[model samples]
Target: MPSATYASRRSELETYFDRTAVEAWARLTSDAPVSRIRATVRAGREAMRAELLSWLPQDLSGRRILDAGCGTGAFSLEAARRGAEVVAVDVSPTLIGLARARAADPGLPGRLDFRVGDMLDAALGRFDHVVAMDSLIHYRSGDIVRALAQLAARTDRSLLFTVAPRTPLLTLMHAVGRLFPRGDRAPAIEPVAEGSLRRRIAREAALAPLAVARSRRIARGFYLSQALELARR
Candidate 1:
């Protein structure tokens, strides 16, 4: 079962995405040459790409993949373009709708499946690879472990994700930012410490660390860490 806080936050995130999807779609589609547009969009997700690629097996040519919290289907589209069957899910209906529209416009509706669903839901089946990037930070400290366990359980190969690192300076900055009005700044989600995150991964089962990269360059002033874990199972 999902916690009340998790559900509430998910609702808030969905609302935000619904309001911004149109603008996001316009921006994502502005560049000429779909490949160029994809590269530009992926520039913001390079850290995620690097870490996720490190954990995946060398050959993914016909394997099925699950992209949890696949906002806008950037990674899912990339994987599908690489020859993998992809099922991309997100809690936001608007984002999934936009993804579906993009796929259809390119005549790739058959290659990708986008759904609106929660990560904690087990109805989604196991896959060769499962990725959740920049999504785990929405959960409070205790919920992360459960989320990671659920992700691992749904994947036979690997689970890849990124989290905002919990450093003292970063924590202080978040605290200060929260004291101001909402319109003045974005609310920063509290990040988990590296040690605590490692412990959570351990609780799920031993996870071999595959790679870690900083996302500072992609998004301005954001101190985030991308991590890949190969599930022991």
Candidate 2:
């Protein structure tokens, strides 16, 4: 079971996303539902997703994938569309509900098992790949160490997720961005020192990085993203 503090923080994050990011998250960035204020952020996500998906096998004909912390199911939908079986999960019921509805629509051709649960604690089966998008922002550095270990355990092929890179400039930017504030939001950005994060995971988790790329560059948002691609021990 997750601790009370974990549960509370998780709830706060879910509420924040459900209220703010979900609408834009559910839509393709080119679509009008993404606000001008949100478009740049959404664009960064879109770019990140496209690049990461390209890392998958050329033929994902019957691969199994886990989409941990799948918000609004954008990546889940895309993976399914590309012919992978996806188990998409989120801590937020609201986001899972949206994803379930989207997956249920007759036009989509893919198998999605959408569930609402804590990724760290879920008893989900193994998969060929595990892709967790921008979900690690919810965790502090210590918490993220645990989360990455779990993700590393479940994937036979590869695991991928994004983290805020802790550069002096980006750290300053995150602090500055928080001041403007979303009315219902609690502070969520947890930037990790790229060097330290890689070293720690290598030493502790034993999940070696196949590739680590900066997906969302400084131009996109105050929060920059680095996508870590890890392989089994």
Candidate 3:
């Protein structure tokens, strides 16, 4: 079960993405022109997506994968092309609609499932691998770990996710972001120290069956996030 804090954060995220930043997000995910800041973010996200895909097997035929918080479904589409059964889910109906629209490419394999709901829902079923890119940055450390624990329970082989790594640059960015107009700003990200996060994950009883496999940090201009992979032992 999701804690009160987790549920609250999820609600806030849904509101922000579904109502506040729909067009902005859609533009960011497309090739259309964007400001320099968002361009850096787009580039950083692309790099991070590639990094995570590189960690997965090249031939994913017959594997089940979950694209948790899949925004616009770029990663999910690629994973499906690689022959994985990809279930791409997010909390925002608007974003999921956009993802479905983009997924109309008939060339893609017939295995991509797009839905709007909590990615932690058991109804989504188990997976061979799960990829959550830039999805947990808004939650507190404890909530983030609990979310991972729930995902770990259902994930069979690996779980890959990203977080807002606590760093001086990210802290400065957060402060600057607050200066933007309230209507234009994204939810404040929760920056966490990587060491502390690792320690917390190690101590969490529900996540005991999984071990940290690898991690990498992606930093570009205004974008800074860390990807961690947990593999079942």
TM-score of each: 0.77, 0.83, 0.95
Clashing pairs in 1: none
lDDT tens digits by residue: candidate 3, 1-233: 99999998899899999998899899999999999999999999999999999999988999999999998999998898888999999999999999999888778654889999999999999999999999999998999999999998889999999999998878888889889996777788999999999999999999999999999999988888999999988
Model 2: residues with Cα > 4 Å off, grouped in runs = 1-8, 19-30, 105-109, 177-184, 205-223
Candidate 3 — which residues are off by over 4 angstroms? 175-184
Best by TM-score: 3
Tell me, by lDDT, which candidate is best.
3
Q: What overall lDDT goes with each candidate model?
A: 0.66, 0.73, 0.93
Write the residue-wise lDDT of candidate 1 on 152-180 in tens digits. Answer: 66676666666667777667877898889
* Candidate 3 lDDT: 0.93
User: In model 1, where do residues sit more than 4 Å from their true spots?
Assistant: 20-44, 105-110, 182-187, 204-223
Q: Who is ahead in TM-score, 2 or 3? A: 3
Q: Candidate order by TM-score, highest to lowest?
A: 3, 2, 1
Superposition error at 84 for model 1 (Å): 1.4
**Candidate 2, residue 107: how far the Cα is off, in Å:** 6.3
